[model samples]
Target: MVVIGSRTPTQIDQVPSAAQIVEGEQLREQTSTGVDLKTALGKLVPGLDFGPQGRTNAGQNMRGRSVQVLIDGVSMNNSRSLSRQFDSIDPFNIERVEVLSGASSLYGGGATGGIINIITKTGEAGGPSWESAAGVTTGFNNSNDFDHRVAQSASGGNDFVTGRIGVAYADNGRHYDAKGDEIFPDIAQSDLQGNRSIDILGNLTFRLSEEQTLDLKAQLYESGYEGDHGVYFPNLDSSTPNLEDAEIRKGFSADREPLTDRRMLNVNYHHANVFGQDLYLQAYHREEESSFHPFPYPDSDGSYYFTTSKQNTTLSGLKMLMSSDITGNVSLDYGVDIDREEFDATQMYFDDDTTDATGGLVHEEERVEPRYPGFQIDGLSAFVQSEWQPTDNWTFGAGIRRQHMDVAIDDFQPSGQSLAEGGKSDYDVTLYNVSALYDFENGHQAWTSYSEGFDLPDPSKYYGHPGQSVSDNPLDGIKTRQVELGWRYQGSRWLTQAAAYYSWSNTTIEPDDNLNIVQRDDKRRDYGLEASATRFLGDHWQFGGTLHALRSEQKIDGEWEKRGITVDPYPSQHTATLHAQWSDMTRSLRLQANRSWDYADYQGDEIEGNTTLDLIGSQRTDFGKISLGVENLTDEQYSTPWGQRAAGFYSPRFGPEYLYDYQGRGRTYTLSWSLEY
Candidate 1:
């Protein structure tokens, strides 16, 4: 199979890194479990940490680091992450997902963990075709706990032109835990339940000539919460600690609700041969507007004020890549990228004098101000890589990239803080990677690689602090170095992969004791082992499993210790997943089990772990294809790692609230129907 480990397409066996492709069918099957893309990916990928299935991707990590998300070839990430990259698009439009594990400079910043490239569906050479699907989900705890979804797509093409368009809509409802308690919505980060979402994807391709082509693509997605429920802290007025979880009170009305809107457009061109080299070029634009839930924060003087936050971000870039053969045994791939990102955030205040227990009861607007100084970052980069097959069984490759960034910020003080004004900052960095692969005739391959990746810390967060200076910037870029060793085996009925990796960075990002975002110039390291195996039990049955063991630590006071919840909040010492599948032309069945091992953090908190099971089955009939999914088949009771971190962060300052626990949803059932012709 062909894969793009770098910009150039190459054979999977020739790639020096671990890579996996989740086909559309697999994605559909996973979606049947009524989980979002983040949760679905975590179950399918061994090294990816799947946090609570929510709208915010707060604790989700790939290989214990940040992951760069991409749709088609356009980047969905900016310096100031909204933590909503997974919600940028609907899964119905995705043809497949490509996952490249470990760190590398092959892409750009924000890939310190790895990369997840979502490939959208494109029309093939065929007559007009259409696909439609509908699904419903419920936790069964209450009559109101029901969700609905519908999607449709159409595609048609001739010899000269081909195109496809798809649209999906979902109306989600409330959720409940195994104990039959309402799952409270996260007031700060927000949650996915009780939300409505819509996504649109369209693309057109033209065969300019036999050796040339052009493609145009666009997508728009939006998700907004209904705000039917609000958080109620039973201990809000109590001085003593209360063990009650944050409760969800119904009929909580609000004039404004949290929302996320994303828009992207792309123009891509390709030529089979240009000056004896294959050429590819793409120009893209991505824009997003995100608004958070309004919450009340107490001022130093004791009065409380209601505030909401909104962020607008835009990214535009042009990328070009060319591949050529230097000789029969040698090849070179090179590319150049020019991009710019501009971000702005605003905070809106609401008069709190008339507000009730639920925040933002008073609709009277007060004022609006910049949450942080607006900023624009421009980057220019160029890279080249060469691959050589010195012998029939060996391949070696190396590459380097030079990046230059200029950050410009508007002169403004952080809200509710006395801070130095923002100005300009410039940075230059060069990153490199090297790899070697050995292939064997017996379907076995071994590979080793070393790579470097980097990302600039969120300027908006650091710049919002007091006494900040552009020259004395605390938003230093973090550079990570990674080394990995891996082995892969592909037999007639069995496929397997095993890999070990370690990554280190001198400067780490974490929250201070007061839950304030901070940058610590201390050495931090993350190490992990990952493995996956799939076997065909028979002509119609298959079995597979994945395993991951990870640890993150930092040097403090000249001693190494496990990172705390504020830093490495994933809390999974070891995670494993097993699955069995049976399929035929007319029917299919799948069963999956996932387990997280218990572990302790640096603060000596015994983080409890849990296990869950899922089952899905489908049958095709003359009317349509019908499917049913049961998530958490055994009704597991567990608190999300992110939720636990929330409790840890709030307990010291406030008191125990039910919402702080972030309990996992209980058993859920989804029924779906689809038709394609």
Candidate 2:
């Protein structure tokens, strides 16, 4: 039964048995707020570590290896940074999220870790239907945010179409101190704090004939944030001015404005009886652009002091898949994929006082155009898999993939200087996986597997800077080795799962001293144990919990001074959450409570363990639905990966002397109402 809910294997034949489908509904519920997918998943899945930090996206660590994310079966992780955000997709549009907990190279290079697939909504064969809903909420810290959404779908004859569009806007007020009297510093002032987003989605499907069908999909997303940097400054003269007044005098010095826009288009066709087997073909293109302007200031001389940067990315790919039943007890699946990606970036520096130091201000303006340049990457992969049921209680699966990658910088220049006269690199990778599933007589199952994964060097990493030492000598690709064993039991109202895994990676890529280029040659290993359980407490109550214990270590092969320079970015051990939900006889009213714990061992040297609690009550009626909730009931002080100490560094450094703060939101409450049609 669990296999039915497990992630669909890319090779089709290497499907999971009964122990891999653990977090589905829980993932959807945790991500309802448009938070980063990794953060949401971390709350439910054991052995997963994720939080907001270095970049806007969530960083993920699964089974001691990095994890890659895919939206609608398309890779979303930026090849250069390995960071991506899932906020662009509306939660309402997701059909499901499938997490494959181990290394997988069959999908393509770049997945030296695990993989997550986000499946989008698709029209089903039926009639026409329309749905719409809207909600508004006001919470503690004077927080007020509202969300409205509407969707319509229909299927007639042999054609089907569906469209969904939504917009969400929030203006979260400043948070107060522990005593609930003073406002926290670094937070945006009451006048400057707010965030807004817009999302649009469309999909159309046409049945060309009995053996062929066509599908088209497109999506657009835009979001912006206006807020102060999460930092507090001591008053210049504490004795002369009050903290509030002193902050006001500073004129909201710490502020950031960021804007992001993204679009995706896809066209796919599926046909059966093509070349005597079921065939699938798809074409997809995605474009994303983002800009950030921090601390924009209008100077006295009609000039502005600002720092702005823009990034643009484009991706296109085509894939073909075929499957056939070779025998009564055996099946085969094969596929080929070709993908290309390009990225371009620009950063500008301007100064208001263009003239030399003097009383007169010069009108001449100078501009510095530092081009990030652009590059192209081509990937080709072919894979074959077989599933064989040799016995009544056992099943065996094996798959192999041969992949080739070609990367080149297209007219790449660093500050207008040529790099390697346009460089290119090619690599070949071979990956194999073997798995077995055994079902006992009592509805219990066990599984064991071994798999390999790899990631090629991205073009950006090789061509970003010219004449840079390490940039001149590109490193080889990265690779991972993984082995896992797990067991599962499912009863009428109770479910339990447990697993243990060990993973090792070679030539890990990491930022060097320059921070402009990355160097490879680091080795790392991760081993962990994880368990989860969900059970019914009563006729109307259900509870669930997940726990994890992990150890990760890294070693850089260099001089003694640098040999131990290892950083464990993920929590070593943690108990994610405990949640319970109950409903009264009326079925119209419901209550829910959740508590999460991060143990001391889970926190880095600079971080401390903290507990968070949330409560919610909802009521439904003919007119609409209403819900009230409170979060951070204890108002605990904590910091996440997003906390920072250095002025230009986005990542927070852990340690007592670092003087870093997490700046978590204090106690907050919310009241929401929804109208449905």
Candidate 3:
């Protein structure tokens, strides 16, 4: 494997001077759980958190701050909500996952946490390859599903052009309630509640000459969800026979369908001069849209009602990079990036007078309008980094960046009342990092670093409430100070890594008791230790495991609150993924098993934790590859991070009764197949 960056190329399997790489085999091993990129990295990296299932819209919090996600060096984060879900792309098309852990303001804004770069498959010149796969499976609950995927690529000519294209699709089935658990009759009758996705990607690379090259790429993604919400509730007491009238059970049947559409285009150029200096230029554009509909209620006139919400966002950027070797042992990289984003949202209400509450009359006109104020943000940043290698086994690195930002909000009202004129804010900040690594005997290395990071206030926070005057106080950005210490050991048959890190953040963003608007000035601290090891047990078996322990604290208004606050909800203690796989043991058979445990954590008023087991077996041959697997083998119950909202409880609400929880899928099984030519 070769590691390529905006500036230079580095060797793999060695202590990299300034870049990171993961081999293709490592990517395949990590993607055993279908196509969940986030979960695939949980065992390979520390200080990365993955939220529970059902919270599909939640973003990833890296090192206690929201991180930026990219594909082939192009940013892919949503401009409006900043959601960072890995489901946007299929894992089957990925070649590797490169994570630049720690503050990286030099790359771009919104990377206060870190940077995740996804590298896709590429076709080699003078080579041709193609692959296709299709399969079906059934499990204990409603786990019967189908999947199909295909990819093809061809390259020729020594220097003219090379291109590749790939596509994938997946349809998943829902899981049933565990034994002894009562199924929600209304939901049981609805369509399957699972995810369906389609992905399309294309790339073309042209070598203009020996000193220059051009690359163009595009991607399209669509995903959908069917059926009712996953949560459930028991019947009310006999005194409340109108239990049917309770907010939780008001509807005899409920269902919803949400969809997302995304498109991206990027173009890049690289040039090298006879003087050994290198330069790069890149321009990109992205657009995304999401629509959600909530099931409407039946009115007295026997009519059904529904509400529709949609968000549209667009982002575009250009970047320039240059690098050169100043001295025999010193090198420098400098770059500048500029970007802009625009966001808009709309909500619509619809009613059907076909049926009544008990066949009663329902009459209302469909009202559609903008749901939030429209906004735009423009930013510019420049940075420089230096690497010095004074000895064969010692290296040092340092980097700093300055960023300027301007945000504009158009005149608009959230509710249909008076218009609130838009406003603008400007900010300039600086960030820096320094690190050193020392190589020891036997391919081992120790490293340490100090980094500074910051997160800009989200644009949604700038709007004023209907009754109060819009406050002039701009949203305060969060500042982070981080310290890290770690070591890595690589051997012929084993690989191990251990790291410990602590981060302190000031002016962290949090919602008040009412959860109406976001506020800053809160303080949060997180410290954690993690270790992972992978070993080849004999010639046919491979084993690996990861263990982590973390502690967090938050201070509100100068007072420390250890519990009952909705700040940093990650579990303080957890053990993930102990797995063993036996491959090529027999003619064409492989067996694998894994176990994981999570400690209780609070999400608002609900506590969640669970232990899960999984098993898999597969057969391979010239015809194709087939595999079967089971997940959540114990049928453990759990709730996701942003699962539910309490009924009629808007602001300052507390207690379990006032909390709504999202439910997780039970035990499930899957069968898959793949063919290559």
Candidate 4:
């Protein structure tokens, strides 16, 4: 398979570092269980943490750090992440996903961990074709636990023009835990349950000439949930082992739950041969609006106060790429990228007594304010990469990128504070990478690489404070250095890949006293090992497994210590998976098992570990194809690593009910049917 996350297409086996590809077919098969892309990716990619599978990707860290998300080579990342990148597109319209592990600046900021590139479907060369699919998921223990989805698409192409269009809709319901108890919505970050979503995708390509083409892509995705229950606190002094979960208060409602709305339009022009080289240009625009959960806090008078916030983001960018062949064994790729981003948040205040009398939180229009000063980032980048095959068995590559950006913040007033002046900061930096791969005659290969990555600290965190001004140049982009060594073997009946990596940086992204994201000046280190192997038992039988172990620490005072949840939210040190598959032309069956090992929290407390199982099967019939998937087959009871830490941290400050870590979901069964013509 070809790996496109590297900014250039290359053979997967030729990649010097760790990487993986999830085919669209595989994605469809996995998502048929009603899980989102985050969960599906976690099940396939080693070293990627799936977090709590909530509405937000708050804890979905890739290789112990942040990941840059993209669709068709266009970035979907904002300064603050907002953690809603996954909601920008539906899995049903994706062609494939390419993942490149480790820090990289090849495509610019937010890749401190790695890159996930979603390739959308395009028209095929032939007559018109169409597909329709429907699916339902439920925990089986409750009537309200059912979720339903439907999707349809059509693709066709001709010598001059081709296009593809798809639409998907889903009505999500409640979720259940291992004990068949209703899972409460996450009051802070939000949950995916109890929402309605719709996604629309379109792609059009025009063959301007035999050697040139133009492509246009557009997408719109929206998901929203109106809360019908209010958050209630109970068990103010419960211990960890005896903590009670938070209960939903009926007849009370939040003014608003959480919401996500995203839209994108992209155009690309390509010339297969531009003066004996390939030239590609892209122009794109994206707009996003997201609403966070309503929060309640105590006022100076001891009365309750409420606040709700929403973010609005606008992005526009242009990119150019050129590929030239210097010789039969040498090639060069160069590109320039220019982009601008505008982000701002608005918060509305509510009075407790008024909200109570109104039966829900009542928005006070006069009390609205900017949650943070609006910010705009304008960036320009230039890069060149080269690859050379010195010998038949040896390949080497090198690349460098120069980056420049200007961050401008608008003046604003924080709550209970006067206006603070905002200013602009200019940043210029250079990043480099090199790699080598040696292929042996026996289908064995070894490779090594050193790469650098850069990131922009979430500006909203620092600018939203009392001072209103941007914090002490904390926007000074984060720079990371990483080294990796990998080995791979591709034999007649087996395939294996393994890698060991170590990365470090001088600055760490963590939370401040007010629980806002901030960049701290401290040396940090992250090391990990990952491996995957697959064996072909026979024509119709195969087995595969993966293992990953990561360690994250930071220097504080004079000692090196494990990073806390506030610093590194996803601290699951070890993960393992095993699966067996049997497939024929008309039918298939698969069984998979996953385990998260017990690990010590930053407080030196042991977090319990758990394992889960999944069973999936499919059969093709004359009318359509039928598939069944059972997730969490054994109904294992466990707390996510992040959930454990959150429970410990929020319990005392807010009620012990916070100690109820969002428990893992119980066994769920999904039934789906699809037909294509």
lDDT of 4 by residue, 109-172 (tens): 9887899999999988787999899999999876778899999999999999999999999888
Instruction: Between candidates 1 and 3, name the one with more favorable lDDT.
Output: 1
Q: Candidate 3, residue 280: CA error in Å?
A: 2.0
User: lDDT for every model?
Assistant: 0.82, 0.54, 0.58, 0.81
What lDDT, from 0 to 1, does candidate 3 have? 0.58
TM-score of each: 0.96, 0.80, 0.84, 0.95
Q: Judge candidate 1 at residue 468 and give its lDDT.
A: 66
Once fitted onto the true fold, the runs of candidate 1 whose alpha carbons sit more than 4 angstroms away are 233-246, 357-364, 414-416, 513-516, 568-573, 654-657
Per-residue lDDT tens digits for candidate 3, residues 340-418, read 9898877665443321232211223356777666788898989898889898777788888888878787777756577
Mark the 10 consecutive residues where model 2 has the least summed lDDT: 355-364
Residue 415, candidate 3: how far off, in angstroms?
4.5
- Name the lDDT value of residue 1 in candidate 4: 81
- Identify the candidate with maximal TM-score: 1
Which digits, one per residue and each the tens of the lDDT, describe model 1 over residues 560-667? 888776573243457889999999999999999989887676778755778999999999999889999999999998987667766776654444444466779899
**lDDT minimum window of 10 residues, candidate 1:** 354-363
The TM-score of predicted model 4 comes to 0.95
Per-candidate alpha-carbon RMSD to the true structure: 2.2, 6.4, 5.2, 3.1
Count of backbone clashes, every candidate in sequence: 5, 5, 14, 0
* Candidate closer to the true structure by TM-score (higher is better), 1 or 3: 1
* Candidate 2 colliding pairs: 139-669, 140-669, 186-231, 606-655, 639-662
